[model samples]
Target: MPLEEIQHWTWVFGRAQQMMLDYSLREIEKARTNDPETPMSGFAAAGGAMLKAQTDFWSDSLKLWQRFLMPEEAPSEARALSEEIGRRADRDKRFSAPAWRDSPLFDLVRQSYLLVSDHLLKGVDAIDGLDARQKERIRFATRGFVDAMSPSNFPLSNPVVIEKTLETRGENLLKGLDHLLSDLGRGQLTHTDSGAFEVGRNVAVTPGKVIKRTPLYELIHYQPTTPQLMRTPLVIFPPWINRYYILDLNPEKSFIRWAVSQGLSVFIVSWKSADAGMKDVTWDDYILRGQIDAIDTVRDLLGVDAVHAIGYCVAGTTLAATLALLAARGEADKVRSATFFTAQVDFADAGELTLFVDDDQLSVIDALANDGFLDGRYMAATFNLLRSRDLIWNYVQNNYLLGQDYAPFDLLYWNGDTTNLPALWHRSYLTDLYRDNKLVQPGALSVDGTPIDLSLVKTPAYIQAGREDHIAPLQSVWKLTEHFAGPMRFLLAGSGHIAGVVNPPTSGKYQYWSHEGTAATLSEFLEKAVETKGSWWPDWIRWIEALDDTRVAARAARMPGKGRLKALEDAPGSYVRAR
Candidate 1:
């Protein structure tokens, strides 16, 4: 509020303003003018939606006022409100400040906001003139704005911020502003204690050697832990969108480390954070040179006919495509068995993410990626919108209002660390797979001059999905069963995308449900599946072993940096270290 403080902000804004690109400014202007990218539905549908929201909001306000005027004994609304007060989500740490519960003024404010938010959020459903994808965009944009304007986000309205400011005699506000300035300088929000963790030293610390390096990715071969090694090596293709260290966050949460310990030679792909040069790298290159080559290298290095493969998220989706490509080329024998983690093959039931690649917004995405590669921050920001209340606003309140530092969270660190996607790869992925739903359509997609057909992918498969996964909806993941002719087993894990896959048995967190018999739908699968508490890693290990539990005497590692597969570097290679 002081002149000096205002002067500091002006200087900061001046510097930031000078650096703004023309395209960025154009985007801002487009947004201001209600751009065509995210068009408002027809006047009738939108008008009706606003009317409904307004009516409900005012009606709820009247009910609240009536309750205050007439002192009634346990009214239904009062009882419901009391029950909601005891409910867990609102009672979580974000709103744990005493004033939120104790202060009548703040309680009414929170309740009013919730009532309006609920109506506004539900306004975009099944609009007459809009398609499913367009409706999703409106819904997402509405939620973003609503979440941004929450009482908890602003210092004056937020109880925790007010309390902190009083407790620290306004010093918290100073620190909060400083944190904001620092984040602005960094060009991204700080989600974790960045200084606390380094990739190879702590997080991706599993002992492995970079056996193969390429333009797209570096393949790491984890040292075998068990005395006897599985004859068929296990190769994992993690989503190129994020670094592979997510599977190796730490020993306890490390999926790679555990797989290695279970008498399996684990080879994982660490994808390069692509630069502008890779803008022309098509999906074919990613399929053939990136994932296929990694598996082939593992086979060549280990002298194996086939390797057991696992794919996570988009990598899982790509694996489905790769399996189809392999099948089309009559080389399906290369991958012994396939396991998918929250991989969506069907876009028909694809959830919120479809909002980004809808017809209108696609042009905007294309324009943004005109520089060859789409900056990952754009995708990261969109993902954050999925759970903005928790992922974005809560962090904003904590980091900027309560004057708290973003805490050290391994998962959040990985979430923030994103990678650029080549323009062709990004466009083709969004258009063919996501928008057009081609993977399920046999002969619809061609990778490396082969018309890929998922039905021909007869490799025995294990598909696991997260019940709460927002990115890859469980239903879409379940749809993989319909197209693949292979014997398939589907499992549902308790958490979202990351935790569900990185789950370790040692931690004893999250339950996984498995159905022995093949079920047609996700509902039928979940209904019959027995819920087993703890990680699904053991179940997967047992399943993968049963395919062919042939064990060979474990081979010792060659001298450091001396062998034919001469280790490029230990464990995580230079590719992952690319910013």
Candidate 2:
């Protein structure tokens, strides 16, 4: 702590304490004046009651602190002692009064004290909050703090306490502080091994021969072991929200490999991570320019009139938009059929995420977009908060108190991968699609003066929903089936978002259920279908294979010439990098 920072913090702490004292005294006076004869059961408790509680909490906190910072003492002994002191304190009634039951002065003063306490505590540089097992481990590790006079972890770890200290400064102050902590945590977790990187690395392990496309991005083409190939090739459109390699992860889990093995030519789109140059790239540009370019490149190389397309998550939205845009321009003949993996086109019921995307929030986002791109850390933090009890709290307990090294879990590592959204596009997306619910309704959204109509899309569609997807709730994604006029099949998977999509047959525990005869919401489908244990991927492949044409296509006389690489050595491409 620098002298300047210490001084600033002290000043804030003093001011907050003063506010708390003033509020407490004022409330006390009000109580006396309002009902002079009333028994002071609540607000008339002894002054030392608050003091005693504070003292007790501090005593326990100090003991815990010593266990961590002290030398020459065994951690187990220290922890046991801390627990004993906590038990003793817990037995005392004086310190156990609920906030509502406490005297007005005590309640107000304590809360004010909390404002100062929080800042002082966070200044210690420790993560706050812990899961059950983690809290148990901390208690065990800091037993020595059981009877210490000085507190360890005495102060609240929440950042809100500091914000209360700076409330007069402005709400923006709190927002900025929150953004700082969020960015710090995100940067640490997403240092490098993000989901995007993992996907790229794992794709290289597919069973068939792999040929490098753009070395910079590790974009490659795969040839199946089987000689027979389907008439029309398959091109996968992955959500830019994550890397494209999720479809081609490990050998057993590889959807792309499975497709190729089923005798189909498969092409996967590997997106490039945008930089300052891509700041102005609009949603329309992605579909019209990016997707169209990839399709043209594929067609020119393969000489295929139409390609089977699969889109997942946000990419499904892009694919939907591309189909709509293409249809409006009479280019629908290029698409044979489409499959959506938990993609949402209608945001009418976008799950718990909707609560945070009102008009007021969009305005703030609009201002943030002035820099052209919205920081990926901001989005990552928001998602982490959604599961705060699990992600944030668990990390704090494991890493800080126990001094344990973070164990690597591929799912969690991938979860930590954060990506940025262009501010303009993010703002427009939230306001137009989520807040307004426009795409499904006619004349709601106009791209380049042309309206987007979902009913106009007549491509055969297969839409699958996971039972538990926090990002795109099953109900919202299922709404797409209602809007599409083409023949559509709806399937339900047993797991959550990423797990459900990356379903490998070997997992063996997965179950798929469907309504069969009726076309309704996912909930309705699950209600009528039988539960069977098996991977949805194999089932999906089977359905897709049945729909595919059987004629085998020999190797073409000409193949798509390799494109020039931006970097001869891999720098950073879309799949191998984080947002």
Candidate 3:
């Protein structure tokens, strides 16, 4: 059955069952009333509560409609629109409702949309003291309803779609159907034109070799582009939820290539795409075999006591936790310095991602563990919902409504490259870090039998947060400074989660903000910050260089198998190529 059909039937059956239960409870209550000594049973009380809630809903709805009907008491938004329509014969061309002023029928349709949208938002707000998750659910549902009702979604109502149909003589609609069928066959929504780019040849094309491999990861040591080099090597820990190639997408935007050109030894931890066999993998396994092992391999290859470590997004949080674990084991000095790129260690205000992460929602996700690993498609869908208008509906219109092909873009290609998450690790992340907010709480979480304490991390830190990031909000990322005992610097980047971090100096695209001193709050830091032109990459490089004094004439680049660990494959390693 189609999902929608199943849902409709489910609702029908649920309502029937509730009605039957209510009838039974009322009969039981009547019998109990005959015996005055008998008290109210649990079932009767539950039915009474349900009845009261239903009554309240109808009462409130009636009051709302009554107020809406009264022109004197009608919402200001509705009144303003009515006044505007009377003044102007033509509607704003920029809006989807251009036909609103064309006829009374169209005007009524537009006004009804506005009035319902206003009421929906006001109604959600009027609910007394809703918890975060409850409020988020309401907002998410409202967005879905509002998007569905958009005039542009319908062929007859949408002026632009109608004009396109006329221009193409209905060819566009046919093409759109084909696009929709293709995506349906793939069992996932198409986000990018996958054919426009190839992995090793164009995307993660930086010249590099995989020197070491674990069941969980492949560590790639990028070739140096300069003759002279800094003594301390830089190892990057990218989020395992997606492929590591995000940092190395294309020549111009590649962070790995830029660091290599700057005479710094670069190594990246390329995580294996998880599957059924990897279902049993634990969070500690990621810390141990994934990151700690990569650190050990890099240190051994470079023959250095410590190296500069960098983590992006989720990897940054894991990296901080790993440092804490190392400190607990008296091995804190192994990392010379730490840099976090749009990663958050604290989850108190983890942004929109946290909305779908409460106990009930997590239970539903946990139920998906029957497949061993959570499907990457599921993760992608959740993220798309965060910015549905752009990520979901935009594609829907192009691929289905308008029959347009996806544009070829490196960043979009990277976005479409999805990876699965091991069930165990996914569950732990949801329950511990997100649900409990345990990382910042000492002894709340343990890795390898040692309790995590973020304050134990004494290594100098550099943290970057994207101003427009919805995944890891800037405020949440800024909380890292409070937990770290070491000297910390925070950078506010201009773009979002992916673009902000991938920004290269050559693009001359976005500006970054840097404060002279760490402030008690993120707001204070932003207020006192000095805006600087260009990418934040140069500032990061300067910070890393300042921490390390030993610079010598660079030696020849280390090839795979030449290092302590033997080379298994070429760049863009086999794990990343996994289906």
Candidate 4:
């Protein structure tokens, strides 16, 4: 039933109860045929107990009402005494039987309580499916209840529950409110789509700065405007979970814009969000058809022999996957150096996310994708649950209690932009990358018949990881240095995942640690690298420039730019436009 209708019916029942005894119950009983005794025996028993207790309370309430209305006692004092009598009356055993339980007066009130409780419980079940963390608190709150008993689960949402309970009526309403509030919170905070990409305005870019390919999969585009013109260009690959533009949030916080002014070319892959058509799009599509193709396009079109390839989060992994595949195919000769920012080539040490990788969870996700895709909302819920306290509680307070509309923050705004993943692709990815941890181990896996071995990645590489990254722990990113056969430099950036990768020197947001010699582990490297102020952008540009020899300018595209590329529907690029 619609919530409003339920509330309306509950309210009507409450008013009717005031007029007579057992009105709704008697009505509900009439709806049944053969003994309403057998099926409703349990409900009848409960109703009988409640009715009896209610009658006793009314008896006392009648006695107290005379005193409460008398001129003797103050109004406030009388009101308090009456409320106390009602409380004691509800719990008294005298009302536990059918004879006195037939008070029509309290039936509507009882119906209201039962109806709301039912609605809230239904909402809680919905929440349980989305957030794993709330399972424990759900269990804790519903403990000892038979029909509404809690499910066994780990306590991820406890902190959220504790905070909510403290904000409302003390213990009296904590259990009921917790279930309802958590449901509202989880529903609001979750999303499953990849990131959103916003292209710089046409005037902002130098004519012909925007570059792309035939199928338009591999793109090396420039956002034109630069604050400090750097000598070399850097390409960034963002995670598939979100769109690529997160690194280049907007004009001010844009790492791309910052890098351009610092004299560096900024090219980013705005990956197309996955859909039913992309169900068959394997990791090879992202590597061979995606990153590798972009590398060739950037290398040939820009007329530069070498440019910097930087990967952020999952994009880092995809970049590494492509690199490893390229190396194994004896194809590393096509490009220049590589950089990974909070990217994991090794998944064994990837932190707390492992708790979610069990077979049961995987199976559940597989079932969800039975129709060939995973819903964006489901994915969003899973990630939000990862940090339930922040995402869940903030929404609960804002949406339910405060009844406020969610204000748009770019990060969250982009986050709410959700996308679907083909079931087959999602299944294969989880099996090979997450559950098996195959890619990190040499020859343990093959991507489209090509054995992926990290040892073959002979290109000069620079890897940056955040000191406080929980998603792709620094230690996990540091693990990449060990398997690479080429010259590698590991830089530890001060901020978490997003901030670390988008670290523009002009932003002054974070410091980066650089070490001279390759270290076996992140801790060892952190113990040795020199501490420096400013963002990692400048450091990276200097490193790439050293690899980039000065070159003559390439011919700019003809006026109106020879239509070497078909417009994949206009502006925000294909990926951003996908969702």
Candidate 1's residue-wise lDDT over 286-334, tens digit each?
8899888988877777778999999999998889888988888889999
Task: List residue ranges in candidate 3 displaced over 4 A.
Answer: 1-115, 556-560
Query: Per-residue lDDT for 429 in model 2?
Result: 75
How displaced is residue 512 in candidate 4, in Å?
A: 2.3
Clashes of 1: 0
lDDT value, residue 36 of candidate 3: 49
| Weakest ten-residue segment in model 4 by summed lDDT | 148-157
Q: What TM-score does prediction 3 earn?
A: 0.83
TM-score of each: 0.88, 0.64, 0.83, 0.63
Give the higher-TM-score candidate: 1 or 2: 1
Residue 373, model 3: lDDT of 90
lDDT to native, each model? 0.79, 0.59, 0.79, 0.59
Model 1 misplaced stretches (Cα beyond 4 Å): 1-54, 68-93, 125-131, 556-563
Stretches of candidate 2 off by over 4 Å are 1-204, 207-220, 363-370, 521-523, 557-575
lDDT of 2 at 121: 38
Q: What is the C-alpha RMSD of each candidate to the true structure, in Å?
A: 9.7, 13.8, 8.5, 14.9
> Please, what are the lDDT tens digits per residue for candidate 4 over residues 241-283?
7755676566666666666555565566766666666667777
Q: What lDDT does model 2 reach?
A: 0.59
